[model samples]
Target chain A: MGIQNTLEGSNTEIPEIGALDVDKIKQDFPILQRKVYGKPLVFLDNAASTQKPLQVIETIQQYYTAENANIHRGVYYLSELATQKYEHSREIVRRFLNARSLKEIVFTYGTTDGINLVAHAFGRKFIKEGDEIIISEMEHHSNIVPWQILCEETGARLRVIPMNDNGELDLDQFRNLINSRTKLVAVVYVSNSLGTVNPIKEIIQSAHEHDIPVLVDGAQAVSHYRIDVQELGCDFFVFSGHKIFGPTGVGVLYAREEILETMNPFRGGGDMIKSVTFERTIYNDLPYRFEAGTPNIAGVIGLGTALEYVENIGYEWIGAHETEVLQYGMNVLSEIKQIRFIGTAQKKAGVISFVVDGVHPHDIGTFLDREGVAIRTGHHCTQPVMDHFNVPATSRASIAMYNKKEDFDALVRGLHKIIKVFS
Target chain B: MDELRELYQEIILDHNKNPKNFGELPDANHSSEGYNPLCGDRIKVFLKVKDGLVEDIKFTGSGCAISRASASVMTTLVKGKTVQEAEELFKRFHDLVTQSPQAEVNLEELDKLAVFAGVREFPSRIKCASLAWHTLIAALKEKQEPISTE
Candidate 1:
């Protein structure tokens, strides 16, 4: 109660606490060396979008500066060079996902685009009126709305697998939800609102048993963990590039080769067609048929460089570091009397969603911003999760490989100041 | 700190802590809901209109301090005033919060709602400050659908 921290009374200086080598990792990102409101930036909004390192940025710049040309069907040297770089990036993505072949990797705008493509191309071909598409209560709006549209368009029933109050999915209910009529099972790899690392591998296995294909929304999961599509046995895996320190406007969709052959093209354009007559047209091939029009060539190259950046710093090290930081943040923030976390699953990632007593999350977000601690404050595109918790929104601080213990300390300090002002 | 203090003034914080007329107006003629989909902040305004005057006004919802406080102060400021007077106040309040920095907003003109003048500094929160006022407009007209500050 003594020396209550108010808006005007507190200074925003964060004392530099020494860390061993995450500091070395942070040096790679140029935006990390930044000040907001004259305070050192404590960026905890990694769940929304990660800041790109210099490697990704420089690669993007190098592409535009030196090799800026259209790919596929150009006979010039520059066109061939750009095409090879673009193909090489696809090879990188194939290796990154451990897909069987480059034919499995198709670049899209982002995860949402990838999901929409599946909804159109796959759903139109396979799904019927009485068929069901199973999703979870913890899905982001991006995952839910597309299926809802597909259901409305095709008369397909959308079944939701319920979750407990702890934000963990009920696999029993999921097993019950699947029947002879269930066409697809799509679930998130990690809950963006609740940090719950879902058992998507098990979900995939259960769906595959019924001869159903599953799509894993790895948008939030790809940045933190190493994903192997072969090991996961998921039929389709989709993720965004910007979430994993890569360029925006680029993403990867990995499907089995045979499945790709069955699905029709999402778009009809120049690159996707082999032979076209006014009377008859034939689709080009596997990955190319899915990737229509001029793609984000520079973005693909930058994404390749970004994945290499993650590879150079192994996932084993990143995962361990994230666990340590998540635990440390939970410990420090739990000390406050008013703090109540929304997600406390048995297994969680670096994201922490909480509500403070008598204070709204938007207010918490504004106060924290003044202290230069960036955190996501909302339903996080998962309104159903917000409704399940019966709270309007949550103040979420999600961490990344570059985040350190001091970031949480800064956040704790900011929250204390906000609580004092409100109290 | 100076900008923060200007934005979170003592009046705004106090009203947020203890909002005025915050409940369901049991005998209300006009009602409307406001939603900010960006942050999921929601507010519902209820008014008992009588003889071209706002006899009573109340609100119930969850949002940031700026929004709740704005709604609270708005109820207090517009109660017992004529519908036309309240509409005029709404115009002044909107101008006070959304006016460009280069253009001067006369404080004495806004009276109680002048604290929201700080809101113009933050473009994102301008919608937050103006949500209740927009909802109040909808309530005045008895709009059936919810008003969204997208």
Candidate 2:
């Protein structure tokens, strides 16, 4: 390497690579110009949460502005309007997932709360003593601990589907772990930590053969892949709205109609009840039984809008674009010798996790921030995956619809500067 | 790019690469391990304390740059200091990394340790920078050979 290409011993100056037109994307968000550290903020933590577009924001505003009222039950005009709008959002979610029916879609707070609800309802009711729940090693703590609690309570066992050296789930091990005792198989459709797009369709099919229910944690998958609940044949599917560029405090859980009918209610309150008395309470049918309380009204509407926006753009183009950007990022980052790119899976989404030999991921993130580059530097809410990889943490860059090739170049230039400092 | 140069100043990288007082203390009187579960950082801190004075200090771990370098710099500063002095150093280091810069950290005494002050600006890395310090404190609290974060 030339002296200019080195961090210290070698020569490398991170080039003046540009990024997405903040001015253009900012036109959509209307929050990008705000100052942080007295500079333009580079928001690189998309995997944690995504920025909302004007359409989603406006949907929330419009909901409150024109169609704000309590839904279902009320006979008044405004109440009916709110009920129709709310139900319309459910249809959007149904179409988004290509679910069999709107009844399959149950709204919750987020993916964590959704998973916990299933653990409490489905896992608690149907799962018997000594039954097994298989999850991949790449699961976030949210996916792991709930089943752990379920197993402890039910005397069931929690089995792990191990990953190979490339951070991909080992199909052989997955098959070995599943048997007559296995009741549920919950796995991330795309790993948040590694960005590996799992073969969930095949995984779900195999589980179904054993009469085992599968729950695909689509928190990281929804934004990257085309999800069809029926096509995948998964018993249940869950994802957070925020991860798909929607509002926080909103999530969707899709369960088979029969499964939803069988599972008991998780929480008791208004709206979930069909008829209430001092002696006995009758629960509402389908989704309303699962969704108690007032719910995140505006959040759901905004999520519908977010879904509409994504559907308009189309997942095929988005997936192709993001995959290309990730490949380009890997190529650009490879130019810097000291940088060690992690998680090179065969089927990956837009995420790229890496480490520069001499520089820490935190230092790299901090340095990159100074140059208007944003990325995540941690175990990414998946500590077990980190342990599997035998790495403390890896700096992650996840691309969305808005990210461009120039963004990858800027990231490369930022890594070059990190190398310069460390070398 | 120029601004990033300031964040990853040469001194920080030097400490990261050829860390001072690196390695393990085989005959250590005290040791402890610290882990940042969120990031998977694991650091083992070893100390040789004789008559309330820290005669030797060392560390070993694989982590992000901030963590490994933090351990590296911590070992260099704590060695040859009294246990009480080491405790105070811990306090100073904590303030230097977690809190605002106004807190007095004894810059000359800090030497290479000062390079890590920039870490405070990045809130997520605070745990990485403090992993070794927490382990050292745990070691002192137990007054034994050591313990691990797990």
RMSD per candidate (Å) reads 8.9, 9.9
DockQ of 1: 0.77
Using alpha carbons, what is the TM-score of model 2? Answer: 0.89
Angstrom error of the Cα, residue B124, model 1: value is 1.3
DockQ for each model: 0.77, 0.59
For model 2, state the Cα shift of residue A294 in Å. Answer: 1.6
Q: For candidate 2, write residues A1-423 as lDDT tens digits.
A: 121122111111112213434345445666555555565555666788888877787778877877788888789877776676667779889989998888899999999999999999998898989889999999989999999999889999999998887879999899999898989999999888788889999999899888899999999888888888998999989999999889999999999999999997999999899999999999998889999999888898788878887776677667776777778877888887787767778988868888777666777777777777778987888888777766778899887767777777777877776676666
Worst 10 residues of 2 chain A by lDDT: A5-14
- Which regions of candidate 1 fall more than 4 Å away from where they truly are? A1-20, B143-150
Q: Pick the candidate with the highest TM-score.
A: 1
Model 1 over residues B1-150: C-alpha lDDT tens digits? 777788899999999999999988777888999999988989999988889999999999999999999999999999999999999999998877777856776767878987887787788788899999999999999833333334
| DockQ-based CAPRI category assigned to the predicted complex of candidate 1 | medium
What do the candidate models score in CA lDDT, each in turn?
0.90, 0.80
